[model samples]
Target: MRQNLLMIEDDARLASMVAEYLDQSGFTVAHAGDGHSGLARLAPDTGLDAPDLVILDLMLPDMDGLEICRRIRALPGAMGHVPVLMLTAKGDAMDRIIGLEIGADDYLPKPFEPRELLARIRAILRRKGEAPASNSKALRFGTLEIDRDARTVTVGGKPCDLTSYQFDLLVALAERAGRVLTRDQIMEAVRGRELEAFDRSIDVHMGRIRAAIEVDAKDPKRILTVRGVGYVFARQQD
Candidate 1:
């Protein structure tokens, strides 16, 4: 079955071109010119199947793309789980970081090649389709539990909300608990993509993950930073 994709972009020409390209790549694409309309289309009353993925532009006439991404994640049930690929015209690293922190699965800067966009879209979708290994077992550290088979996490026996990307990143770290993994290693292990030089969105995603599972996000115990090397999931936790 073809996956349904919703694109929230104000550029008619660019939107048309991208929709055409993604359509040829085997996705059913829908376009909305602004954030409000995009949200409307995603509403349950619209009678549209919840989008399997979203292509969201940073500069919308009605609202910032980061805000849209947050609202999308706030949607109920499966609708909230839709992966978002953020598009930004800004070269500022902060924009991308904020996008990922708010649950965007991936991001691409403007003037990106259509092929790269397609590759990224497929990559995010591939991560979504991935399942735990046949012999995978749940990982437990202190009061935290990561259920590999169910792809769920609990802290102190309470559910912790994590985006799919964040969940995968956590699994990668927990699988190698106590070992410091560079950002490149973590990204490649969880995303199968090379780390773009100077892209620290991974750190932002880690911050969000810490917020979800840590007793104190500002003083995290589960995922610890190794100064300049990378991050490590504690083998022994308090």
Candidate 2:
């Protein structure tokens, strides 16, 4: 099946080129020239079908693409959980970090080869797809429950609001509860890709996960950080 994608970019030429490239590569790509238009396309009441993923440009004519991403995440229901792949300027490490912190599933630097873009999109979708293939197994740690097939995390029976990427990250940690996974190991397990040097996106996602599952995110009890190292999911939690 051809996956549906919404590309929100201001550069007309780039949008056209990318849409064509992805279409030939077996994806249905819709183009939106600005942030408002992009968000509007994602509206549930709109006649348009919701996209499977979004390819958002960090720079837009009317609004910051980061704000658009935040709005997308703020949208109610499943619409808010749609995966987003951000396009950022090459070497703009900070922008990528900020993008991940605000819920982007992945990012590709600008002036990229379409092949890499395709790889990134496929990787993101693949990871997302792999999350729910566990025969509906549910991992229980105290009041925290992770439903693998449902791809959900609940604390004390209350649903936790987490983006798709964050949910997968949580699952990766919870699946290996009590292991001290380095940043690279966590990224590899969740992303199935090599970690870019100095990439702190994992840390940002971890912080987001803690906020959702920990009663006190400031002093997390479930996902613990090891200073000068990575993080570990406490096997014992209440």
Candidate 3:
């Protein structure tokens, strides 16, 4: 089945081009010229079906992309789980970080090649399609529970809110508990991509994952940093 995507961008020419490209790439694309219209399309009664993924521009006409992202995540039920890919201007590191922190599944800087965009979209969707390995259906560490079949996590019996990407990252680490995996290994394991030099996107996503699962985000115990290396999931959790 062809997946549906909603592109919320103010640039008419760019939107048209992107829509055309994505259409050719086996996706149905919907365009919203502004944040309000984007939100309206996502509304339950708007007659606009909810999209499988959302491509949101960092700069919208009536609202900041971060705000739109927040609204999308705040939506009820499965709507809140729809993956979001943010489009940001090059060198706008802060926006990218903030977007990820606010629940965006991934981001691409402006001037990105359509091929890269397609690759990222495929990666995100692939991650979403993943199920638990045949070896295990669920993983439990102390009070934290990761249900692979359901694609849900809970801490101390309370549900934890994680973006699709973050959940995959956490699972990747937890599956290799006690082993220190390099950034490259982790990214490849979860995203099927190699780590770029000086790329701190994983670190940002780690922080977000910790915030959702750790009892104290300031001092995380579940995912420990290895300083010069990468990270390790504590084999012993309490």
lDDT of 2 by residue, 18-118 (tens): 99999998999889999999998998889666688999999898999899999999888778888999999999898988998888988888899999899
**Model number with the top TM-score:** 3
| Deviating ranges (above 4 Å) for candidate 3 | none
Error of 2 at 65 (Å): 0.6
lDDT by residue for model 1 over 147-194, one digit each (tens)? 988888998889888888888999999999989999889987886555
lDDT of 3 by residue, 43-103 (tens): 8676655788999999987999999999999998777789999999999988988999999
Report the Cα lDDT for candidate 1: 0.89
Candidate that would win on lDDT:
3
> Which sections of candidate 1 miss by over 4 Å?
none
Better of 2 and 3 by lDDT: 3
When summed lDDT is taken over every stretch of 10 residues in candidate 2, the lowest stretch is 127-136
lDDT over C-alpha atoms for residue 29 of model 1: 87
Q: What lDDT does the true structure give each of the candidates?
A: 0.89, 0.87, 0.90
* Ordering by TM-score: 3, 1, 2
